[model samples]
Structure formats: C-alpha cells, structure tokens
Target: MAYQLPALPYDYTALEPAISKTTLEFHHDKHHASYVSKYNAAVEGTDFDKMAIEDVIKSIAGDPSKSGLFNNAAQAWNHSFYWNSMKPGGGGMPTGALASKLNADFGSYDKFVEAFKAAGGGQFGSGWAWLVVDGGTLKVTKTGNAENPLHLGQTPLLTMDVWEHAYYLDYQNKRPDYIAEFLGKLVNWDFAAANFAAA
Candidate 1:
C-alpha cells in the first residue's frame, strides 16, 4: 500500500500562536503531502513498496542511486514524527524517566535545552534537529536536508523540523524565535517520554 499523509493529532488551530493555523495547513497539507506523494511514486512497483518506511530508509540511505527515494521517504517519515513531537499544550521541563535521562545525559534540563536548541539553530539549511538514543546515551544531533538519526544507527526520541517551510510563514526570518517557541511552549514531553522508554 502507498504511504498516506497522516492527519495531525490536533486541530489546525490547536497549536496556534506557537504554530499558526495557516502555517500548519500549508506545512501539513502542502509540503508534507507532497513528500508522501513523491515517496509513494518513488517506491511504487519497487521492493521498497513491500517494506516498512523505516526499513526502506535504512536500506537505501547513503546510496547515490537511491537518493531521491531516500529523500522523499525520509521526509515523509520525519514529518510524521515531527507532528507528534509537539502537542496543543506541551513543553517546559519533562518528567519521569525521560526527565531523569535528560538530566543524567546533559547534566540538567537547562543544559539539554541549550544543546537541543543549538542543534536546531545551528542546522545550516533545510533539515532537522533530533533527540536520539545513540548506543544507550541520549544525544542531540542535527541533519541536513532529508536526513535523520535513523540513518546513523540511532533511535529518535523527538524531532524539530528546521526546514524553512516549517516556520517561514509564522516566524519569517527569525528562526531562533521559532525554535524558542517550539521548546518553551510547543514540544510534547509525553511523546518524548514514550519514545525514550521504548528505546
């Protein structure tokens, strides 16, 4: 079956102020939908069509001939993850095992915030910033266009889409402001905690 665009868990206006309705509509309905369509087209009638999205991504990552397939597939997967990475009323400090893990790995919540925001801000261009478990340690990392932690043998716990389309309609040229809101007001700690436990 062809991969389909997943609906946002919340309403278009649910993430307002942090993520505007207009931005959500365009980002989800246009940009993300495009990636899903392209990915389906790329994988149609191919062996990848029979594999899970993650499996396809891992199998073809870094192969020059499969770059197109990888790009669309990764973006499709990334956007799906990105939507759940935030919630209507989320952000601030995390709690439970995930909070403890962040504190242990990064020294404190503030330090973890610094590292995660830095990863998102420091990304040179269209890409993603991730909180991933690498070799059993929590880490902050960034990837250039269409790449993600899965390609690096890491398990992703959370993600922030740093692509221009993700924030341009809302924050304009002020990406730092967008990143700040994403952390202070929009990030979903519950989702991260669940991913952490699973990892």
Candidate 2:
C-alpha cells in the first residue's frame, strides 16, 4: 500500500504552551502531509508501490538514482514516528526497565538529557537526533536530512526533529529552547519504553 500520513495521537492544541497549536497544525497537516503525498507519488508504478514505508526507505537509501524517493519516504516515516514520540503530558525522564537501561548506557537521566540535547542542537542543518539500539547497545546519534537509524541497521528508541519547521513558529530561532521543552515536558517516555522493550 502507498504511504499515508499517520494521525496525531492527541489534538493539535494538546501540546500547547510548550508547542503551539499553530505549529502542530502546520507541521502535521502541511509539512507531514506533503511528505506522504510526495512519497506516494514517488512510489507510484514502481516496485516500491506496495512496500511498507520502512522497507521503501531502506531500499532507496544510498541509491543516488532514488534519492528523491528516499527523501520523501524517509521523511514520511520519520514524521509518523516523531508524532508518537511525544504526548500531551509526557517527558521528564523514563522509568522501569527503560530507565535502568538509560542509566546503564548513559550514566544517568541527566546525562542522557545532556547528550540528547547536544545531539539535537549540534545537528548543523535539517536533520534529527536519535536514541537508538545499535547492536544491542544504546547509543545517541544524529542524521542529516531524511536519514534515520533504520537505514543504519539500528533500532530507534526515540527521536527529536531539529528541522526548522519543527520549532520555528513555537520557539522562533531558539532551537535549544524547543529541544528543552521536548525533553523536559513533551517526550513520551511510555512510547520510548515500548520501543526499547521491543528492541
């Protein structure tokens, strides 16, 4: 089946104050929807037409001839994952097994936050910062443009979109403030835990 835009788990205004409703509306409805549309168009009549979004991304990634398809398909998948990475009242550290793993892998929750923020903030251009399971070990990584951990044989446990469209309207040019809100008040730890458990 063709790739499609995934619905947000919460209402657009649900993340307000930290993230404005206007930002969600434009980001989800406009930005994400556009990626899905372009991705579908790119795969039309091709072998990727019926492939899963993740499969399509992996298949196209690094193939110069399919760069456009890779960009759109990866963006479509990334945005869907990004939506689930947050919730209205989420964030402020994880717990249980996931919490233990974070401490084991990154020293402590505060250290994880510092590393995550640094990864997100250090992304020089449109990109993402991710916490992923690479070869059964938790690692923090960053990818430029539409790149994601999946393409590198890693399992993404959590991600933060550093693209200007993700925070420009809400935090203006202060990407660090936006990153702080996402980590301090918006991250969906349950979702991360779920991803972690599955990984």
Candidate 3:
C-alpha cells in the first residue's frame, strides 16, 4: 500500500500551549505530508512498492544506494509515531509494568527523565530521541535525521521529535524547554505502556 499521512489523534488546538496549532498545521500538513508523498513517489513500481513500511525501513536502512528512499520512508513512519507519542493531557510517571521497567532500567523515574532529556538535548541536530527496547532492556537513544530504532534492531516504545520544526515556532531556540514540556505535560505514557507490553 502507498504510505498515507495519518491524521493527528486530537484536534489541531488540542496540544495548545505546548505545541501550537500553527506548528501542527505546518508540521503535519506540510512536512509530514511531504514525507508520505515523497516516499510513495520514490517507491512506486519498485521492489519495495508492496512491502510494509517497517520491512522497507529494515531492508534499506543502512544501504547508501537507498538513502533517499530511506529518508522519506523513515520520516513518514517516524512522524506517525511521534504524533501518537503524546496526548492532550499526558505526562508524568507511568504506572504498572511499564513504570516498574523504567524504574528498573534507569534507577528511578527522575533518572529516566534525566537520561531521556539528555538524549533529546544532546542530539546534535535534526533527529529524534527514543525510548526503545533493546535486548530486553529499556533504553533512551537518539538518531540523527530521519533515523530511528528500526534502523538499529530495537523495538521503539516512545519518541520525541527534536527536529527544529517540531518546536522552533513555539520555543524558538530553546530546545531544552521543548523537551521539558514534552516530558512534563505532553508525553503519552499509556502509549508507551502499550508498546512496552508488546515488546
């Protein structure tokens, strides 16, 4: 199937103070829509045309010859994941098995926040910070430009888009503030929990 742009789970104004409707308009309607269209155009009638996006991503991730396809396909997938990674009133420590896992893996919820924020803050440029299951362990990792856990054989549970377009309009150059808002008031722990359970 040709990749399609997924609609935001909530209204454009739902994210409000943290992520403005204007940002969502440009980011989702323009940027994300471009990736989907690009990926479809790039993959048309190719060997990858019928492959699921995840399969295409894994197959082409590190191949230099497929970099263009990889970038579009991966960005399309990543943006979809990014939207679901947050909810209208989501954030704070998770509960149940996922909560215990975070505490176990990162020592405490505070430590997980530290490490997660560090991963996002430390990413040098346009990229993503991820919470993923790697070898049965929960880890925080970052990838530069259209890259994600799928490229590294990990199961992604949650993600934050640290790309400038993700936060620039609202926070200007203060990415740390964006990351803080994401962790404090926008993260969807239930989504993470579901992913963790399946992982």
Report lDDT per candidate: 0.94, 0.91, 0.95
User: How do the residues 31-92 of candidate 1 rate in per-residue lDDT, one tens digit apiece?
Assistant: 99999999999888988899999999999998999999899999999999999999988989
TM-score of each: 0.99, 0.98, 0.99
Clash pairs, model 3 backbone: none
Cα deviation at 147, candidate 1, in Å, is 0.2
Residue-by-residue lDDT tens digits, candidate 3, 1-199 = 7887998999999998999999999999999999999999999998899999999999998899999999999999999999999999988889999999889999999999999999999999899999999999999999999998996889999999999999999999999999999999999999999999998
Which candidate number maximizes lDDT? 3
List the pairs of residues colliding in candidate 1: none
Which is the better candidate, 2 or 3, if ranked by lDDT? 3
Off by over 4 Å in 2: none
lDDT of 2 by residue, 1-199 (tens): 7776888999989998899999999999999999999988877898889788888888778999988888988898999999999999988979899899889999999999898999999999899999999988888999999999898999998899999999999888999999999998999989989999998
